[model samples]
Target: MMGLENGITDIPYEVHSSEDLGRYLIAARDLMPGDLVLTERPLVFAPKALPDPEACMPCVGCYKPVLTDVGERCAKCGWPVCSGNCPGLRDVRHHAAECEVLSLRPDCVLDNMAEYYRHDALLSLRCLLLQKTDPENWKKLLEMQSHMECRTPGTESYDEADEFVVQYLMNNFINKFDGKLKKDVPESSKAILHRICGIVDTNALEIRLQQGTELLGLYSNTCVMEHSCIPNTKHSFVHSPKDKNDVFKITVKIVVPVVKGSHITTMYSHALWGTQARRQHLKDSKYFACKCQRCSDPTELGTYLSAMKCLGDGNNPCDGIHFPEDPLDDESDWACNKCKVKVSSSQVNMLISQMGEQVDNVQMMGGSVPTLENLLCRLSTFLHPNHYHIYSIKHSLVQLYGRQPNYMSQEYLDKKIKMCNDLINITKTLDPGNARLSLYRSVLQHELHSALVLTSKKANSDGSFKSDEDVKALLVEAKTAIEDALNCLKDDMEETAGKKLYAVIEKTKKEFEKYCKEKQLNI
Candidate 1:
């Protein structure tokens, strides 16, 4: 029998055709929660940069040329520093929290990189750097990620608290550890703790905000984490504020209980469906016939046993799949969630074609607010969660919500901001530049600011609270949001999937930046 010794140590698992997932299965060992999973350095980790890329433009926090393809490494700390005015270098809050780790790992280089791992030679090395910086936290996070993944993904009580903690550590470490202390510790102790955290990204910024795909988890040795239809982990990319650079990291939450040997799975598809649909997805993309308990019920604990996303108005279009249906055509019709009836294929195709064209227009006319929204609603009707175009659509939507030019409503702003928040969790898998997301996030941020302003105005007439404090909060948000979008163009879209996408990202960044600066903002 092919047992653990016979090259089947990890139990039965299917590797997807899209990736070399099985390649990371380097050795046979009993998988455990918080086990030291395989870690490797990527062979190619260059940021997305176009020729004549924008040179370091100091980040708002410290007027330093945030390190990027064109930035520099600090003399004292290997951590990237922007330039002479780089406050990131002199920030006391950061120095003490970061120094010890920097002292221990002399050659430990925090790089802003992109690309795939061609080999495992540097896996141990990278892990060593992680271990050196914060062995306890790194070990804890990997374990948390593995253990929670053993539980189901979406069903568990969602907790943002744990997600934020893990996110704070990894993202900050990568971003050159520039986070201000969460608590108001004494300046001396804060410096010490900051040294412990080291120079890295605060994760205060992210390019992508989506959860890690099952496909990406394969990048780490922790693939043995159990599959949950709904996952606690979310992955994304961020550029270092200290030294401008873009690299992505995966984030996980401790909200779920993870038993050892359970394969961690995320709701790789959209969250709007039941177990059967999610299982079919797992089977198709991941190549695993999921025996997860949810699949046995198919309706996901009766969640979608009798529902439909598009069957209300008696226009049940292409709701279900027709065998031998053409992928290039369309499947944008509705199906009875209860009865399992679908619309005709021809009609579905018609809808899909219209939406696709709508998206193209938004991309073409990036500055148009109305056009972007029209494109978003149409795609939300068909595409699965984290679909590529959703990145483009959501980014546009977030921007529009902020600057409604007129008739800005607080209700829609709340709805749209939450929408971007959820979508960002999914985008972590699809878009790493966070810059791509910056545009959308900016919109949501602006809308939220508008809401606060409206609230302050209402409070003013009623004398409920101080409008100055409220206004400052609102103004800061608007600046942060706008800065996020500008950062993308400034960073030059230097992160992409393949070489072709990389080129496209850089080109878009440059042209967009040029387009904006020329428009001459009042600032």
Candidate 2:
């Protein structure tokens, strides 16, 4: 293999294909954790279109927010933009060709905002423009999987894309001007638009700007990794300061050591979602039923994220947990581990649905420690201790116990510490390298440190400490936890919650050190 690597020496991964797993990335050689697998600029990027059209209003030119009702219109295209001097307005790689195409329409500029702007069609237009502006990238885009057969005419995805994107671009931009383009408009066709929409839906990754504006970005090499419930690769965004054309670049790194010929993986669904939820989301969005190791296990690697408590009949009040007999088979019956009582999938679904609505309502009410605690206590009756729904409520309570007022009792502190430890352990087992659970782990560490500190302070106030050595030990552990939290959040960007918590933890560490020094307790 070493002798065969004659031409490509720098690349760390190679693309491989099979009948079951389409095109996917595989390790080119033995790679260690944190090894840079790939770094690639986006093929194309545009502001994300939301369900609510007014949710995000970024300028098509510079990708900056257009603050006013009627933003500064482009002289050529009559579209909302940040300013006349925005660099992206005239760049051939971005908005220039789209501007030329939009300039051809008779009703290019309209008085009504909704009539004037179609946010959903913006990205499709940008992708279509690539055919003419950047032919090399256009070929690369075509090579990506679109799953157009699965997204046929009558499908919800197909109809939505056709109505919102394809027809909008056609009726407004191309066909509105005598069904002819003046040599500059990128080649547009219904089939091509359908493919582009499918490609964007399947491959685009969400990128958030420093100003909190979210955009969708499609990358060439980064999208090749296959999906897994437990992924071995993690990717982060790097803001490119030197290159203005590519505002954001993504860097993919291995979270665990990989042997040569092994598949490089990334999680496509939320890490906290249970097996059923994760599989369903993957099937609906990416068009696949994932049978990964984590998905196939009924125990979910011992997290029991999908387990429920059995409510046995009055004749035998049994204390047993119910888990799916076959996690891969959605219709399979769930059986109790101890009592051997069986329940149908529909019964479990109905229970989960009812619990889900309650959970949603409580979360929306927002974090009052007492309220969340009460909710968690009630959920414990039906859910396993490590159920995903209970984990959700406990996550809120963990942060709230120490941060909120009137909840600093010794009991609350102990509860906070226990929840932090449990969640950290579960996440560690599920995501060994903290790749997917970095933010959660960071917060858990910070909360654990806070609880330990408060506990020590309470002990001192009550004169219950054995000696200053005990206080010193607690402070030392607290310092170590805060440092670990900081390490977990080191790669977070400036505007993120992790960075903000990083700053808070930094101050807390300094204060702890200072207090220890003043008390003549060296740490």
Candidate 3:
């Protein structure tokens, strides 16, 4: 096959299309891990249509949070803006046009404004504005698959969103812009509006803004990449500095090496989700059944992420794992790997549902280690050690151990260390290079370092040199692990959690070096 290149020469991937998969991206040349495969600027991005009330409110123009409710509102439109001097508000193509329309609407006047009018139409309206202001970008957006036929008019997803677009947006805003403009408002056809909404729903990526508020971004190029449960490339959104224009850029990097001609993929579903859950999400949201390698494998690449415990005997539980006989079939039987005991898929589903409810209840109680521990013990009766549900409880414990009151005892710390290590191993096999794995690895290293320091202090108080060599060796190990975590997190420091963790790890490194010097050990 011949390679086709876009205007950007540095991008290693090119878009390709087929009847079955539609448009997908393929690597034009060999790409190593951490190599930049593509960089994309969003054609039209906006805050989520209906964000949680508790979420920070973002500026209408730039999508950055105003930090306080009292921040500046546009003089003409009365919508949130960072400041009167905000550059985004001055852009003729975007905010200036939006302000002009809102200024003409008497219902949008500050005192007469309704709550529904403020939010329900912003995203779709922004998209409409893009069509008028940037025709080239609108053309690019129209090339994307909207899957409009699948989004039938009566469907729940289509009904509410379509009503909001037609009633609140087109009627209240676009059609009403009649006599107020020097130029007449562009006619937005219902068919075109429906197609735009479908495109946004199908391909928009969830991105975090500068103040950590989430927004939906529609990238012209990156939207064409296919979804995979085991994706080779990872993508992150970087916000432009305040000095620069408020443009957001997505950087796609290969997490695993890709040979020339291999298709570059990105994940749409959560990495930690099981095959069944991932497939269901893809089917519902993207309108396709994913037959990815990870989804087809019963053992989930040997991590047994969806395994259940075998019920062999009342006295001694079977050490076997239970998995779906045919993972692709929702009604497939679940069979034990060792005992060959088969159970109907319905029975297995019911058990999992009950367990999930119980887990949700425990999570709602929040930070109760004893409650979580008791629940984990009870769940062990029916769930295999490597099951996703069991891993969820263990994952909670890792966060609770040292932070909770009275849970920092040496015994608990040791248990925490072991659980963190186990989770790290599971993640390495199933979700390696994931941001969560880097976090767990960092937590484990920190806990180990703390434990070693305490042990060395106790031993020194008792005048013992036996543990000196052991402590030194452990300190080196902890130091090395933190270094690995630092490397993993170097590119992610823009996030709040990453920033705090980066500071903590940097301080810990200095402390480790100081301790080594005091002990006269060359580590």
**How would you encode candidate 3's per-residue C-alpha lDDT over 127-203 as one tens digit per residue?**
77765677777778888888888888898668866786656666656666665342533547677778888888889
Question: How accurate locally, in lDDT, is each candidate?
Answer: 0.37, 0.80, 0.72
> Cα lDDT of model 1 overall?
0.37
* The best candidate in terms of TM-score: 2
What is candidate 2's lDDT per residue for 1-523, written digit by digit as tens?
2112223357777778888888888888898888887777788877764334443367777677774355687788777778988888877655786777778664543344654577667778888878667788888899989999799989988999988888888877767544345354446778888999999999998877765567888887778789988899877786656766546777778888889998889988988888988988888899999999999999999899989988886578778999999999889899999886899999998988898889899899885776777888888998999999998898888888877678878888888999999988887878876678888888888899989888777765455764667767777888888888888876675335666778888898888778778777767
Where does model 3 exceed 4 Å of error? Answer: 1-7, 49-51, 54-56, 64-72, 81-85, 92-94, 108-120, 179-187, 241-246, 313-317, 403-405, 435-466
Which of 2 and 3 is ahead in TM-score? 2
Question: How many residue pairs clash per model?
Answer: 69, 0, 0
Tens digit of lDDT per residue, candidate 1, span 185-232?
A: 212232222322121111111232121111111123233334444543
Could you tell which candidate, 2 or 3, scores higher by lDDT? 2
Which structure is stronger by lDDT: 1 or 3? 3
Candidate 2, overall lDDT?
Answer: 0.80
Q: How accurate is candidate 3 locally (lDDT)?
A: 0.72
Off by over 4 Å in 1: 1-39, 43-257, 265-334, 338-341, 344-350, 373-395, 402-404, 407-450, 459-523
